[model samples]
Target chain A: MRRVAITGAGTINPLGHSVQATQQAMRDGVCGIGELDIRDVERLSIRLGGQVKGYDPDSRFNRQQLALFDRFTQFTLVAAEEAIAQSGLDFDGGLAAESGVVLGTSGGGLNTQDENYRAVYEEGKNRVHPFIVPKLMNNAAASHVSMRFNLKGPSFTVATACASSNHAMGQAFWLIRGGAAKVIVTGGSESMLCFGGVKAWEGLRVMSKDACRPFSANRNGMVQGEGAGVFVFEDYDHAKARSANILAEVVGFSMTSDAADIVMPSQDGAARAISGALKDAGINAEQVGYINAHGTGTAANDKTECAAVSNVFGHHANEVLISSTKSMHGHLIGGTGAVELLACLMALKDGVIAPTIGYQEPDPECALDVVPNEAREASVAYVLSNAFAFGGLNAVLALKKA
Target chain B: MSENVKDRVIQIIAEQAVLEPADVSMDQSLSDLGVDSMGLVEAIFAIEESFDITVPFNANEPEKSDFDISSVASVVAAVEQFVAEKSA
Candidate 1:
């Protein structure tokens, strides 16, 4: 099997609009979550979220492009542009045919759906936008990325809820490793902070009204976040031969389903994915120095994830520094895993561990050494990013230093 | 109204546990009836919607929560009290 290398990375998450800004924010242990400013904010009991602030879509896209791009797709395109630009690859000839795009998103064109639904149902409108279907499709982001980059190979979208990005990235890594593609632009995007989106999640009663404090004893629940993170996954030889500036090596990826519950996470399933990634990467548990936890501040997720890590790594679990950047970025749902991968890349590439901010108290249930409250400088060779979604779907990616 | 609340609460829990109302025992804990964390949350939501009264149950720290969910009887009793208090 061929190796896969992450040649480029880009993001427009709540933390920052660029990879550098996001990384700097992570290193600063900044909290990007705050009072959400979106449509129907007054209707939401949970007012806080990680909405990408200061984003003006009109300034970024043309009239024609803006008509076809939803907020999620817009975020994806912006991030993909950065990733492709950083990789310094112009897909013109055979490279365009050998490259592809795979993205993950739970709600495609949610803004369009929310707007059109309000138009027809609330305002009693007679018609909706003609491009609504094209703009709101699940694969719209991937399709646009493929079209923009001239990548015609194996392009699609993955929608595994919160684990969407991990599953998508895992597939991209496999495609490169298995020689199905020489390059793949992969990640996820989400813009579900609209009134309808928040209204639906409010029904679940798992959303925090204040902030997301993962692993904290007094934590309430997760806060919804929005944005996208995209990366260029290239064949190792292909990248090296081109003298590309490889960001990090995608060593292994593993996904597992709980098959037990629609909402509750399973420790066994999560452990299997964690250990599976380690085994797939041919690395022992001790070799991993950092983990980007799927630490949704919800009580069930944090405790269940901690238990899974303890089960897999045992004593090494306490020694390894684990943090959930979700505390900083809020929970991005389907786009979360991709944004959280930034934390893993920081660990492997920059030797910095992003802190799990908002940790006020310690819980015995989560006894692992969570790098809390502040970022820590740590030299780590191997790292893991975990994303356990609703519907008992769990996806974990293992990364190594370039 | 209290008795009706009890029946409704038990029915919701039973449905979440995938058990028939006849098979559900008031004395049984939710765990004993196969109601995991997710089921318990769903049960809480159902009870809230059914009675129009919010149950102060926190899935993270259920013990610290004001609501009691140790047993079907406890859940029914809690719902009954909330319903009566709301009506009063």
Candidate 2:
């Protein structure tokens, strides 16, 4: 199998709007979560979120594109532009035909859906926006990304709840490794911090009313976040031949289904994916120096994830520097793993470990070293990013230093 | 009213566990009866809806939650107390 290299990366998350800026935020342990500024915020019980503040859609897109693109799609295009620009590779002729786009988003055009639903239900409107269907479709982000970049090969979207981005990126890696596509523009975007979005989650009651403090004893719940993280995954040989700057090497990826419960995470299922990723990467547990955990600041996820890591790495689990950037960026839901991957890259490229901010006290159940409340410098050869989603879907990615 | 609440709570929990009311042991934990986290949540929802009384349950911190879910009898007792307090 061919090795896949991440040549370029970009993001517009609550932490920052670019790769450098986001990394700086991670280094400084900046918390982007605060009072949400969505419409009808007062109506929802949960008003705090990690919103992409100071973002101006008008400055990025024209009237026509704006009309066609939803907030999530716009985020994808913006992030993808940065990634493609950094990759310094143009898709044309055979390359254009072979490349594609795959993205993950739980709430595709949720802002559009919220508006139309309000228009018909609240305002009793007889008609809605004509482009609502296209804008609100789950594949809208991936389709728009493909159209923007002239990627005419295999293009699709993944919607496995929170594990969407990991699942999408894992598929992209396999496609490249299997000689299917030389390059795949892949990542995820989500912009669900709207009235209807928060209201829906309010029903589930998993949201934190205060803050997201992953692995902390007093942690309330997960906080919703919005943004996008896109990357250019290319064949390693192709990138090397072109002298492209490789950010990290995608060594291994594995996905598993718990087949157990809808929302409850299974330790066995999570451990399988974690251990499977190491085995697929052909590396032992001792080589893994860091892990970007799916620590959602919820009781079940933190403890379950810690137990799974312990089960997989044993004594090495206590040594591995594991942290949840979700404590800083909030839970991006579908787009989370994509943004969290940035932290994994930081560990490899920058030799810096992102901290799990907002940690007040440590729980014995989650007794692993969480890199609590502050960033640290560490040179690690291998890092793993874990994403365990609702519906018992698990995706784990193993990355190596470039 | 006490007897009604007990029966309703037992029936809701039994339904969630996919067991007959007679088969459900009051001393058995929800997990022992095959009620996973989602099942427990659904049972709580059902209990709340049936009695029109809110149960103070947190999915994340089930152990810390005021509503006891250690066993069927404990859940029933907690519901009965909440119901009585509501009527009082």
Top-DockQ structure, candidate number? 2
Interface RMSD, every prediction, one decimal place: 2.1, 1.8
Task: List TM-scores of chain B, every candidate.
Answer: 0.94, 0.95
Give model 2's TM-score for chain A to 2 decimal places.
Answer: 0.99
What tens-digit string does per-residue lDDT give for candidate 2 at A1-402?
Answer: 899999999999999999999999999999999999978998877889999998999999999898889999988988999999999989867898889998999988999989999999999999997899998999998988888788988889999999999999999999899998999999899999999999888766678888899999998789999999999999999999999999999999999999998888999999999999999999999999999999999888999999999999999987999999998899999899999999999999999999999999979999999999999999999999999999999999999999
What is candidate 2's TM-score against the reference? 0.91
CA-lDDT, candidates in order: 0.91, 0.92
Question: What is the DockQ for all candidates, taken in turn?
Answer: 0.37, 0.40
lDDT for A172 (candidate 2): 92
lDDT of 2 by residue, B1-88 (tens): 8889888998998998888988988899899999977787788889888988877776766677789888889999999999999999
In model 2, how large is the Cα lDDT of residue A31?
94
